[model samples]
Target: MSIQRVVAVVQDGAEPFGLGAICEVWAEPYHPDDDNPVFDFTVCTEHPGVVTGRAGFDLVVEHGLEAMADADLVCISPKHDFDHHAPAVVEAVREAHERGAWIFAHCSSSFLLGQAGLLDGRRCTTHWRYAEQLQRAFPKALVDPDVLYVEDDRIVTGAGSAAGIDAALHLLRRHFGAKVAATAARRIVVPPHRDGGQAQFVRAPVREHEAETLAPLLAWISGHLDESLTVERLARRAHMSPRTFARRFRDETGTTPLQWITNQRVALAEELLENSDLGVEQIAQRAGFGNGATLRHHFTRVRGIAPLAYRRRFTCIESA
Candidate 1:
């Protein structure tokens, strides 16, 4: 179903960043000629009164939990006390889900969905810090702590602050098409999609020395993405045996050489699609994918949309 109305549920101690992330994606108005869908966005709390945020600030919310009853999308922002959400708010979420309205939970707000019993037997995720707690609290919910977001049926759960944007964009892409989502992402000056999962954000042992050694080679590879790059070629450039380079590259970059190259090539293709008038075949060759079919194979795998479709949505042009 097309999303026309979005209601974000806020409460005492709401995280400002999480709320802002949802508002930025759904509430912001862009150019009328861009064909972007305009949503009727509302912010409501369980009680229509002054609500304090975690940052020691206050907001006077005018809408109540009932505002979410007919919303096409209902969003829940993080709160300080995940365990003790208002019964009214939980009921609002459950009702929205029952009626087939899309429900989104950002960060600790997933706990509210858990309380509402909406997450039972569903795939969900939240901030890695709270992943274990959420899983322990709701054992029946399939919680994937490694992804930036998880979408099961119509319910979406974002990992943390910025992942909210990703989840919102994902929904937009599903409802309005890639072009509309890309326009929204461009207006916000954020990438339409991100590479990898939230696992990339998790803390890992530092490889400071190895990173320092590979820094120059990494930069060189980025500049020469159009060239054929293999582990053997990179190892020769780094003055190391292929076996040693392969192991060290994984330790330093947390990904294999081929995977890193593919990501960089896809990124380059995205920039070309947004800012240039190049066709898919030319862009594919320029980004080292060899051909349009090859480019489409990797681009669709990484960005969830074809290169041509992404360009159609994001390319800036003058009207006659």
Candidate 2:
């Protein structure tokens, strides 16, 4: 579906960066020669005047909730209180969903979609910290906290903060194709697509003793991601039994050693894709994926895009 008209609904305690993400992607007009689609974007609120943000600043929003009625895409920016939302805002979101307009919720705004009863029986996501609360509050929604965003039908829910950019660019990619989306991403100076899910960003609770013990091992592993790193090898390096090291690693890093190494390899591949002219086969070998096919397998699983496609969209060299 074509998304020509867009509206971002904000309220008191709304985060500026989340709201700004929407504005940056949809509202800003890029050069026409760049083949970028121009959206008729508006920022609306229930009380159209001054909306205070969590950062102790105010935004002068002139449009009211009614503006969303004509929008092809309606976005909900993160607000402070998920339990208490303005009735009009909730109703507007519900009405928009019913009318088949695309609904994009940033960060905690998924709670607003839940309040509107739109998330029921759908897969959605929010910030990892709030994922449990959202799932508990809305038992019908299948919440996947590990993803950067989730698209169930027309409703799109993004994880915390900057994932809003990922969600917005994804919608643009769907509607305008990868080339146009890449143009927009280039204008913003961000990779056209980022690899991996929110699992890499979720902060794990660190046990003091385990953290102190694993600090050196973790540092060494990060620097040598290209090497074949097994639990046995890591345990030997740390001077502990494999069983004991596995338990301690989980306690400190919240992930298995193999999984951590795979994540790091994917990160390294991402850097090489964006910065180098190397082919997928070469990148895979450099990133310790063994071959192109293996790299494609893991890269697709983690980044939701293939290695070559990601390179085409994000490669920095003009000749690439």
Candidate 3:
């Protein structure tokens, strides 16, 4: 199979890290002599040659708009200001979208794509600081202000500079398998993926009365996950009926008690997998999975990998 073609647009007053991120993902040769190449990337400018960056330096690009003709993917990094978008740059962005290219924009670059009407009716994101401006400019676009990135089909937008790496890795995971994406992540020293969306980092929700009462019960349940943690056992610990405990758990955590415990167990299992030299069965027992087979099933469901394989990939214990 042939490599995918990607054209990254460069402009005056561009953020160095933002632009470098796009280039790194699409152009930098990480794996040499690979049978299948990742991407054939070209840096293009509205004017071929010198373009000033946000840090007050000029970068030279030999390719121009013609580079987009063969591009399967087009990435636009943050330029100066939305109001200063060059006509040629906007038109090229529009034309590339019209020709069925998967478009990606990092940081404020989404503003230019929004200006070109490419983000109309599409869910997208930009840097959190400028998210309000982008929303105000393009009311038709669904602007997710809290996300690190939003994947709206062929149009992908990332927030901030480092978040671009996350977005790019997500794109890699979409195109390639999880293993390939994981390999790419190791090469770049970034997280393989972040689950549960960006909502986890926003302001915490206020807990209700019953949930507040479950604190001690929650601590006890966490400590004894190895034992059979049935609803009856938890209810007895909390001095409540099983039905009431279940209802209260759901209301307080916005999820069932069982689900919350499962998440905690999976997280503990991941920590052991990464830090301890324990066998899968040992880790499974400590994390309340009972056995390796049970652990494998739940680990795959939550972490997208088998227990041993995950350990082999992420284990990093330092012997003192």
Error of 3 at 13 (Å): 0.3
Q: Whose TM-score is higher: candidate 2's or candidate 3's? A: 2
Q: Rank the candidates by lDDT, best first.
A: 1, 2, 3
lDDT of 2 by residue, 103-161 (tens): 99999999999988998999999998999999999999999887788887899999888
As for lDDT, the candidate ahead, 1 or 2, is: 1
Indicate which candidate wins on lDDT: 1
Worst 10 residues of 2 by lDDT: 195-204
Pairs that collide, model 3: none
Per-residue alpha-carbon lDDT of candidate 1 for residues 118-208, written as tens digits (9 for 90 to 100): 8899999998899999999999999988777888879989988787898888788667655667778888788776543434363345656
* CA shift of 10, model 2, Å: 0.7
Cα RMSD of all models vs. native, in order, equals: 4.9, 6.0, 9.1
Give per-residue lDDT, candidate 2, residue 208.
67
Please tell me which model should have the higher lDDT, number 1 or number 3: 1
lDDT of 3 by residue, 1-320 (tens): 12299899988887899888887677767466332246788999888988888786889889998898878888998877644688888898888778778888988899988878988899998888888888898999999887778877578898887888888876665555345555666777886664323421333356566445667777787788888888898888777899987877765554567766776687677767666788888888999989888888887886567767766654554321
User: How do these models rank on TM-score, best leading?
Assistant: 1, 2, 3
Quote the RMSD, in angstroms, for model 2.
6.0
Compute the lDDT for candidate 2: 0.83
What's the residue-level lDDT of 305 in candidate 1?
A: 80
In order of appearance, the predictions have TM-scores of 0.74, 0.66, 0.64
